[model samples]
Target: MTARPLGVEIACDGPTGHYDCPHNAAIRAQFTSRTARQVRADGRRDGWRARPGGLDICPDCVKETTR
Candidate 1:
């Protein structure tokens, strides 16, 4: 049996409704190969929450955290 690829979910603490955020797009592009487990682990380590869904991150939140 083949393992299904889990959809990546982003749990942002900032503003909601980031469906059009470019940073979210970049994240999707950047971690195209990252498994759901990996993303969850990283989120745990970074104080964020990663689940399985169609969640997204906004550009302002990205700038605030990454800076």
Candidate 2:
């Protein structure tokens, strides 16, 4: 997620109203995990990445950039 002048942006809830995707969303709802590795785990699960320079890249954007 990126930062705006106001609140931070979030990539999880997409157009289909779910993270991962709409396909699996029907089987489960979103949950907040209170874990030590939330950021890294979520990134690995969703293909997100927080760069050393402080840039946050979502899965979809990552694909575009790589291509």
Among all candidates shown, the one with the greatest TM-score: 2
Across residues 1-67, which tens digit of lDDT does each residue of candidate 2 receive?
A: 9963432233433332223433222111125533424544556576665555444556655564577
Task: Evaluate all candidate structures by whole-model CA lDDT and list the values in order.
Answer: 0.47, 0.44
lDDT of 1 by residue, 1-67 (tens): 8997556654453534433543343233125436655555555555443324545344455455467
The number of the candidate with the highest lDDT is 1
Per-residue error (Å), model 2, residue 18: 26
Residue pairs in steric clash, candidate 2?
none
Which residue pairs does candidate 1 place in steric collision? none
Deviation of model 2 at 10, angstroms? 4.2
RMSD of each: 7.0, 11.2
